[model samples]
Target: MVDRKKSPKKTRNLEESRKEILEAAFWEIFTRSFQGVSVDDIVGKTSLTKGAFYHQFPTKLDLGYALVDEVIKPMTYSRWIDPLKEYENPIEGILAQLKNLIGKAKPSELRYGCPLNNLVQEMAPVDKGFKERLENALNYWIDGMEKELKRAKEGGYLKKDVNTRQAAHFVVMAHEGFYGMLKALDDPKAFDALYDSLKRYFATIRS
Candidate 1:
């Protein structure tokens, strides 16, 4: 018979180790770019040895994909998707979300830009596996915005003729473009202008 107490503790410890490895990999890849960061760099950030790291991730590519699937996807969902649910005004919710993101930004975030956008630009053209996974994450962002916009239109927050598909596409493009420019210029103040532009764009969508 299984010892229920010991078995649950063992499972919890294993899961914790797996999460620790992914957390290490996430920051390493974010700072160095996924292609530039080696497995050794990630292991160096954690207490786990090479063997323990390999036991959890099996290979570098697996760790990268897990970072995309488990860590990054959930972060984006919480930041960009979850708050939109049950919101009375899609435009206000979106604008508030952007402002919240900007409020939390640091100099380092502006310098490195978003990890998702970084991978999309660097790996999409050359790497199929990375491209597919990155695209899935991007689609999740776009689709969530598209859904909220559609709800707003249906509920009379948007103009009767507003095209939600285009609106959603514009939002994703603007955000990605803003982050790319911010990273290239290493200027957090650039968000002020971008925020103003975004506000004007949101104003146009109001009923």
Candidate 2:
């Protein structure tokens, strides 16, 4: 029976719809390269029609930029900065935050390299827009790491000989390395090894 008055369940606004499409694009780009995906790949994840897609994102390039702006950049900021900003002991703070992620991470998630990293590696080289956006995201990562390292230095947790920039880069780089290792082996133990090794490294640098 058709209702006389159709209920307005309501739909997302432009910004909200844009965010949804970008998130779908993030997942699609993670599983495949940017060039490998299409507007259909993104809209497929949503209930909205192609009209909605074009209304929010006129091109894949617009979606790619928004993907980095919303997802990648903030994720990088959180992973590499939040611990440092919130905790007094920079080194242990970083390690503890990582362990917290391990504690909560679903077993299924352990099998993929970070979705953002996957897209960054695959799309950064092939698309100029992606390349710029990826760099913007990575810069947030590097800056966050540098901030933590600076805190460690000031707190006397690191040796004067330690180059903060280098140390920070190493930390972020090693994290990606561990995630890549996890994807290849699908072993939480590999992540365990990484956590343990970083813990030991932090112990050495502790005040």
Candidate 3:
């Protein structure tokens, strides 16, 4: 009789399967709110079966948690955190990253708003687990920004009186608000206005 079991090379690795599910879940949750997308919807987006999904993620909530931790956190770090290290003036780095993101944003991204902000609006209030995980992600971003802003202050790039912590929080809140406005207005012009306004805000804190 022929062997029915899959060969080692053909069998999907745990990490690969988990990553597939996370990527599918990321888009599903990004386009549709986390509460809006179902397990079937997420699985359907992937090549994997429901059994395979369950094997990788015991529960849909578990999958959501993993998505936030693995995908969203890293994305936040890359876009907002890591790039700051490349510039001596964190203010310039912040503005450059924002400009880059705005310049590259697709229509759908503007329409949908930010994924992290979307989840914060959709899931944070209703679910404690989600609220904690999402807040942790936000805090991570805030902490990174705070560190950079502190460095800027020490480097004399920011006003000596500027509170780095508050500045970081404001930057994050303003960033989220910019996306929120874009999502609500569905107009690309709003980005230019917001970008200009953010530039002005940064000017106020400059040394």
Could you give candidate 1's per-residue lDDT for residues 1-207 as a string of tens digits?
978879988988889989999998888888889889898888899888899888888888889888888998778878887898847877777777777785458877678888888888887888888889999998888888899999999989889889998998899888888778888878778888888999888788778
TM-score of each: 0.91, 0.84, 0.92
RMSD of each: 1.9, 5.5, 3.4
Q: Over the stretch 31-127, how does candidate 3's per-residue lDDT look in tens digits? A: 9888898999999998889999999889988998888889998898889989999999888998888778864688776888888999899888888
Superposed by TM-score, candidate 2 places the C-alpha of residue 201 at a distance from the truth, in angstroms, of 2.8
Minimum summed lDDT over a 10-residue window in model 3 is located at 3-12
Positional deviation of 43 in candidate 2, in angstroms? 1.1
Instruction: Please name the candidate that would achieve the greatest lDDT relative to the true structure.
Output: 3
lDDT score, candidate 1, position 180: 84
Between candidates 2 and 3, name the one with more favorable lDDT: 3
The digit string of per-residue lDDT tens for model 2 on 1-207 reads 856354333333666777777777877877676778888877899877999999887888887788788877897677767856777678877777677775346668766567667777777778888888777777778888888888878887788778888788788877777778877887776677888888887667555
> Considering lDDT, where higher is better, how would the candidates rank from best to worst?
3, 1, 2
TM-score winner between 1 and 3, please give it.
Answer: 3
